[model samples]
Every structure is written in structure tokens, then in C-alpha cells.
Target: MSASDSSPELSSEIALLRQPGLIGCLAGRNLSAFSSQVQAVAVGWQIYALTHSAAALGFAGLAQFLPMLLLTLPAGHVADQFNRRRIVITCQVIEASAACLMAIASWQHWIGAWALYVLVALFGACRAFEMPAQQTFLPAIVPVSLFPRAAALSSSLFQVACIAGPSLGGVLYGFGADTCYALCAIGFAISALATSSIRLRFPARQRQPITLESVMGGIAFLRRQRPMFGAISLDLFAVLLGGATALLPLYAEDILHAGPVALGFLRAGPAMGAVLMAGIMTRWPIRHNAGRTMFFSVAVFGVATIVFGLSHSILVSILALMVLGAADVVSVMVRGALVQLGTPDEMRGRVSAVNMLFIGSSNQLGEFESGMMAAWMGAVPAVVIGGVGTLIVTVLWMRLFPGLRDLDRLDDIKPAD
Candidate 1:
């Protein structure tokens, strides 16, 4: 399409970005994505340096994710009760400090597997709190009417950073891994400042004082909601099984014969796809059969993963990964909007935290599983089988949660008062 042909959609999206609060939120997201990529490279290199084991690299990933499983509930409760902007800035400061600690260790040549592991564990713990606050605050920035478009735009910007950050990290590593670590620390500082700038108009709390029972009630609420449960679980298992990210270093060196630059591109492929899909979603909202679309998108994700696993050619592998990324983003957008529309305003924070836990846990645990499975079956076979597993799980999930597959439109649903 010509530039003029795309002008209307681009114009609409640009208008959304012009909203001061949304811009601030996007700034925060951009910095976070950059920091995440730098951390990925730093951890990948450190593990590869210490143990030279793909499994160990996967364990590094586990260190980051393990906290989400343990702290996600409390994080949700805190987000519901507190100032989300303050919460995000606080976490960013701590996360920045942690990155600096790792940089110092790398500079002194004192870094080891255990030290990196410890730092990542700490990082994960802080992130458990940060994510819920970040997500819960988005709807406050943009009006409820703009959420579908705004969410797509925000997710797209994050993916843009995902593409840029790793590619830059790969370039920076030529100087030294410590350089990348230091840069990531700076990224966190920027994230803190950006988050501090956002002006949130949160709805006043209607519930009584925060309590353990109230938080647990959120979990109980989820248990009774079948469509929400299915959507969350589907992404969790599909991503867990289909994840090949933790193994990118191996693919770069042993399989594709690419250097750090190529590894960066490989890592960024999915984000590139996600950005593309996000752009598409902004103009054309998915209105009907939302559940079925999610299933098909994820199933396509599995197919793309299978293609990526079997391909050794750099171009082919990148294409496969890009396809996978696009498919996953579609599912992500649909499911996220579904959760937002389906839950009550009072319950948004707690429910969002629950949804995020599964999503966040899946990303981390998927890495662990990928690393362990790759160690046993070797990378190619491991990835291929994981893709197959994702497909099977999707089929079973569809059968088990027909409600999700039957969802028609976000406009038709109403949150309980």
C-alpha cells in the first residue's frame, strides 16, 4: 500500500500517542523493553561464559521468572491499594541498582553463574510487583472507549523497543558485556523518570482496607470464570511449550553461524512481527468470534514455531520467527482486551494481576522448559516437539473451554457491578 493509503490509520494511532498520559506510559514501556533485551543478552553471555551449557542459560531465565509465581498475588494487592506510578518508579530504581551491581561484578571479572543467578532472582521479585501496576494503570490513562486501540498502540511501541534494544545490545557487546549492563542500568533510570511523569487519575477505592482475604477473593473469582481461565491458561501453556527465545544464543552460534549482531536480529524477529500485528490491530478491531480468533492465532503460533525449529537458514528462520511473533501478538491483544472488558472496574487490578501472573510465569517457565528440554533432545528436536506440544494443548484447551471459543465481541460483554 502507498503511504497515503496507510495515512488514516497512522494518523489515528499518532493521535492516541499524543495523549500526555499515554505518551508517558509508552515511554515507560519503551525503556522497560530496552532494559529487558539488554538483560537477556547480559544473562545469555554470562551463562554461556560460566557453564557453556544451554541448560544453564535456561536456568538463568528461570531465576528471572521464579519470582512471578511467588509474588504475583501480593503484587496485585499492592497495585490495587497504592499509587501505581509510585510503585513503578520504586521498582525501576531497585531494578536499576540490581543491574549496576551486576555491571560492577562483570567489570571486576568477579561475575559467576551463582552471582548472576542471585541478581536475576532479585530482579524477578521486583518485576512481580511492577507488571501488575503497569498494566492496571493503562486504562486510567486512556478513556475506556479508546482501550482497544490504545492497548494495541502501547503493545506495539513496546515491541518496537524489543526490536531496537536487543539489536543494540548485540552491538554494545562488542565493547564488553559490562558495557551492555551499564547501558541497561541507564535504561532503568530512564524508565523510572518516565513513569514518574505519568499523571494517573485512578478511581477512588470503594472497598474497605486492603486485606489478605480480599486478595484471595480475586483468586476465587478467577476460579469461577471459565472463559477467562481458558484464555489465560491457553497462552501460558502455548508460550511455555512454543518458546524458543532462551535458546537463541545456541541457534546463533551453533546452528546459524551468526555473531552477536545476528543473534540480536534473531531475538528481535518476534517483536518485529508483534509490532506489525499491533499496527494492524489499531485500525481494525477484532469484533466477533474473539475466542475463536485467539485459538487460531495461537495455533498458527505453534505452526510458526515448528517451522522455525526445523529451519537452519538465517532468512528462513527469521521469517518463521516473525510469523510466530505476529500470531502470538494477535492472541495477546484479544485476550487482554477480553479480560479488561469482562472484569468489574473495582476488580480490575486484582484480576489483571492474576492474568499477568499466568502470562509472566509462562514466559519464564517456558524458558526453563526450553533450556531443559533442549539439553536432553538437542535444540532442533526440542523446539519441534515443543511446537507440537503447543498444538496439542491448544486443541485440548478448546475442547475444555468452549466458552472462550464462543466469545463474539467485547462490546457485548459487561462487567458485573
Candidate 2:
């Protein structure tokens, strides 16, 4: 078969890569990911410095995710209702502007823990709008056949930024917190500018008056799909329980006695593993029983998390985290590609939005769980327990949803007209 006729394979991906706007969009996403990690590392450092409390660090993590919970559905609605490119660009601007404000606050030494939390809340609000818009917009840029490759490519680039950003943030923090914040601002600004240059034709949806009913329809649809709910909820529960990320600042400060540069390495460890995994996925797409693959990957992730939690040495922790990251990347790739393929074009935004809720909950609620648990049991113990808990959840999910594991193809789940 000629390349175009091949199932969403690498050659098909090459065709999409030849398109005009994709590179620019990819570049924008890279910069955006960089800025986000920088912001996170800086904030984590600042909170830890001020409070010397792991719980506080967890709360800082929570602040960023809380708004995602509130705005994700509405944001998804707006993405579906309007121009996705425009929505993405607007979100980029908002995020960049927020970064600028944060930089100024840092320069002036005006930021407190509470103020930082508030700023992160605002960042999260922008994120809710940004993610769905971007996710839905990709199919417009590339053919549906190339989505797996596109997903892998996007995942790889994002992981690269993630790998670099944290290490850079840590080094910059050693020089000055303000410098890290400034870098974040610059990253965001570049992302905003790059996003502006991309253009695409978006599919139109019939206008429906905004109401709770309208939003709930999407929720109800997702609720009825066992694989969709299982995939999303498994991620939510596993990550929330196994979230050792929120405790990194504490580990850097108290246990490892690492400086900012070391902190960056600590943060980048997972991304490095994820980058490697993403690159492999690019070459070899998950072809059969991808849901089962995701489950196994997450199980490995939980085990790695447990190892990370128990390790006191930086080297061991980094190794454990790298493994966790690798595992998580596998799961993320399968789940992301599946969701994109499974959801209808018209319902993509809403379904993506529902997915975002799980993403936010897994990430943010995990932070909260980590923080509260750290408060009660101490950071080390909390992370350790959370990791074990993630393993348990993974096993339970496997037993509870056999169909999820048997999911063989995205084309199998298309909604009937």
C-alpha cells in the first residue's frame, strides 16, 4: 500500500508533518510546556523555602489544579462552540500575561505563599481552556489517520520541554528565584506568539443555548462508556493516590540536601524517561489491546512510585522516578490516542473536557491527597503509602473492568448515527 493508505502509521504521519501550520503549533506547545514546568519548579521552591513544610508544597500543587476542576467542562464547551485556534491563542496570551505578572511579583519580592497560590489558581483557569482547545484542534491540523503519530510526536516534544525545563528552573533558582520566573514569562510569551501564527479550518457545531443540561449530556455519555470511564477513572485514582510529585521539594530540601540544580534533576528525571518512551512509541504504535497495555504500564508506574517513595538516596529516587515516568508515558500515549480516535468530531470537545476533569482530578486531587497525607504521616510515609495504594487501585480496576483491558481498537467504539 502507498503511505496514505497505511493505517495511521509513520508514513501517514509524515504527510501530516508536511502540512503548513502543524510545526508552528507543535513549537507553541513545546514552549508552553516549558513555561509550565518552570513555573511549577519555581513555585515549589518558593513555597518550600518559605514554609519548610511538605504539606505547604502539596497545597501549592493543589492550587494549580483546583481551577481545572471548576472550569474544565465550561472551557471544553467554549472550545466546541467557537474557534479552537482562537481559543488556544487567547489562552496562551492569558497564561503569558499571568507569567509576566508572576515575574514582576518575584522581582519585587512581593509574592507570599497565599499570593502564589492565587496566581496558580488563575493559571489553572487558563489551562482548563487551553488544553481542550489544543486537543480538539489537532485533528483539524492533521488527518484522523495520523493521530497516533501526532500524539506520539506531541508527547515527545512536550516531554523534551519537561525534561529540560525543571533542570533549568533548578539551576536558575540557584542564581535567583526571579530569574526562574523571568524564564517562565519568556517561555509563555514565545508560546503566545507562536500560537498566533498557526491557522486552520474548524468544524462548525450547531449552537445550543448554554445550560447545565447541555453540559451534563457529555458527562452522561462518558458515564455510560465503560472503557472511557475506566481509563479516565483509573488514571484519576492511581495518580491521586500515588502522587509523589508534590513531595519533590521536600525531598530536595530535607532528605537529599540537594541544591536548586539538583532539584531540577529531580524534577526532570521522569520527563527524561517519558521522553525515551515517547520516542519509542513514535516508531511503534500500540496496535492491539491498548487498554490492557495501559493498565500494565500504570501498574508498573505504581511500583516505580512506591520505589521512589521508599528511596532516601537521590540516585535511587531518580531511577525510580525515571521508571515511573516511562510507565506513565506508555499509559498516557495509549489513553490519549484511544480517546482521540474513539470520540466523534462533534463530541470531541466535550469528551476531551470530561477527560480533562479526570486529568485535573488525578493531578490536583493527587496533590491534595499527597499534602494531607504528608501532613498526617510525614512526606516519606505519605508518598510510600500512596504508591502502594496506586498499585492496589490498578489491580482492582483490572478486575472490575475486563472490557477495558480487552479494548482492541478505537474504530470499534465509533458512535452510531
Question: Could you tell me which residue pairs clash in candidate 2?
Answer: none
Error of 2 at 40 (Å): 0.3
* Cα lDDT of model 2 by residue, 233-333, tens digit: 89889888887788888788788888778789989999999999999887786777887888899989888988888888999989898999989988887
Candidate achieving the largest lDDT: 1
Give the Cα lDDT of each candidate.
0.85, 0.83
Give lDDT tens digits, candidate 1, residues 1-417. Answer: 766787765766666777777777889878987897888876886687678798997898789888888888878887887777888899999989988888888999998899888988998898888888888767666656677888888778888988988888888888888898999999999999998888887777764565788777567777788888788889999998999999999999899988888888898899999999988887787768888999999999999999999998999999998999999988888778767777776677788888888887788888999999999989999999999999999999999999888988765666644
- For candidate 2, the clash count comes to 0
Per-model RMSD to reference: 2.9, 2.4
- Looking at model 1, residue 204 earns an lDDT score of 76
List the candidate 1 regions with Cα displacement exceeding 4 Å: 1-15, 18-20, 206-212
The C-alpha local distance difference test score for the whole of candidate 1 amounts to 0.85
